[model samples]
Target: MVELLTARGCDVIATVGDGDGLLAAVATHAPDVAVVDIRMPPTHTDEGIRAAIQLRAAHPGVGVLVFSQHAEPAWAARLLAGEASGIGYLLKERVSATADFIEALHRVAAGGVALDPEIVSRMFNTGSRPLDRLTERERVVLDLMAQGHSNRSIAELLVISERAVEKHAASIFTKFDLPPTAADNRRVKAVVAYLQESKP
Candidate 1:
């Protein structure tokens, strides 16, 4: 990961082992973004998630990108507890793709969300009829949106017109009770609603 980031022109400041060392390295190096693993030494259960929360509380300016194998909805919700900006949660598979992984890091560092599509699907499975309210095509559109895909990209991926994608997105927002407004990000809000309604 450090090699990839460095190749992309990002400075590799410090690397640590355990969560405590992670915090120490962040305090010392103060890197623009920190990529954390979900499991660390010792307990290795949720040490990394705990460390991420602590990192956010201690250094609000530092962006956090959690790359983990587990797509556990509960942990994802916990990591995104307070502020959604400058935070990202991705599955391990996403990181295997160099371009997407780098893009996710850049997005988080630039104060955007990078949620994994699988995590969103897990959240949807745990939800009640909120997801069922949408048609299969709308659900596909929503899934793409949750994966942080642009309307054009979603259209291309689904082989549909951009206008159709926009229509589906609008319908999804309405069905999810996310009104279009400047005060809130409709896409993020809809995803948040799914996360909030999800069970562990």
Candidate 2:
């Protein structure tokens, strides 16, 4: 990864073994962008992304390009919990395409988005948007969800059982691929996805 990036004129900063070290290096050196992996030392679950979120808050000027083994909607949504500017998420496999990777890096550094092809396709593909996966009833529940309705509220609004609304919301979340995680706000992310797909 270092060789691929350096060959394209990206200055190689310190590479650390843990997320804390990565955050510290960025704070110390303050590079234009930081390439972070999703998993790191210890848990290897979401250390890198958690660090990236911290970096986003601590240093808004520094862009974050998260590289992960898979293009997961859950992680992608978590990374994009707030602003989308200066954020990029790409599958590790996409790095094999030198030009694409470099372009994504540059775009993120310049406060633009550069999502992986598969993610982008899943997001914006005509007739195949992620929203399409939801059933009609689930779509209604999601619309209520986007409007800040709780499961009980949604149930009341729709004249259904709260348990039914919960089931529908859970189905909505699953279909949207926004998995539950303690580190990330799955509800807010779900609304973001809902609103994004709602955009014309």
Candidate 3:
């Protein structure tokens, strides 16, 4: 993974063996972003997720990329409990696509979300009542929004006018009953709504 990132021109900072070391390295080195494995040495269960959460709270400026061998919507939900910006989650299998992985890294480092498409699909299909209220097009727009795409970007991808994307966004917010709130980021709130519903 380090090789792939370095080959893509990212500075390869220190690599550590345990979650403790990871936190320490971040405090000391203060890298722009940290790519973490979801399972770690001792338990190999959720040490990485715990560490990532701690890192986010301690250094909100540092971006995080949670790369895991398996898809765990529950874990993803836990990681994103509070904030979603400057964070990403992707299946390890995606690393095989060099360009895609690099793009994800860049996006997260720039304070954007980069959820895996599979994660988005799983969350959408998790049978949330509010989500079921959305039209098919609205659902598509919501999925792109969850991926941290701006309205313009979503419009370009869907080949629709930016105004249409705005309309879909408004509809989604209304369906979810998430009226604009200064205390919350609406996009992250929408994502949290979807993920919270996906909880078993």
* Top candidate, metric TM-score: 3
Stretches off by above 4 angstroms in model 2 are 124-200
Output the lDDT of residue 40, model 1.
89
Tell me how far the alpha carbon of residue 188 in candidate 2 is from the true structure, in angstroms, after superposition.
Answer: 16
- lDDT, candidate 1, 1-200, per-residue tens: 77877888888888888899999999998888899998988888889999999999999888999978878877877877777677889988886798998998998898778898788878667646778899989888878877778889999999999999989988888998888776667777677777766645
**Index of the highest-lDDT prediction:** 3
The full ranking of all candidates by lDDT, starting with the best, is 3, 1, 2
In candidate 2, how many Å is residue 164 off? 41
Residues 1-200, model 3: lDDT tens digits: 88888888999889998899999999999998999999998999999999999999999999999988877788889888867788899999999988988999999998888899889988888777988899999999989988778999999999999999988998888888899887657877788777877667
Choose 2 or 3, whichever is better by TM-score. Answer: 3
Rank the models by TM-score, top first.
3, 1, 2
Report every candidate's CA lDDT.
0.84, 0.76, 0.89
For model 2, residues 8-45, the per-residue Cα lDDT tens digits are 98899888888889889998999999999999998999
| TM-scores for all predictions | 0.86, 0.64, 0.95
TM-score of 1: 0.86
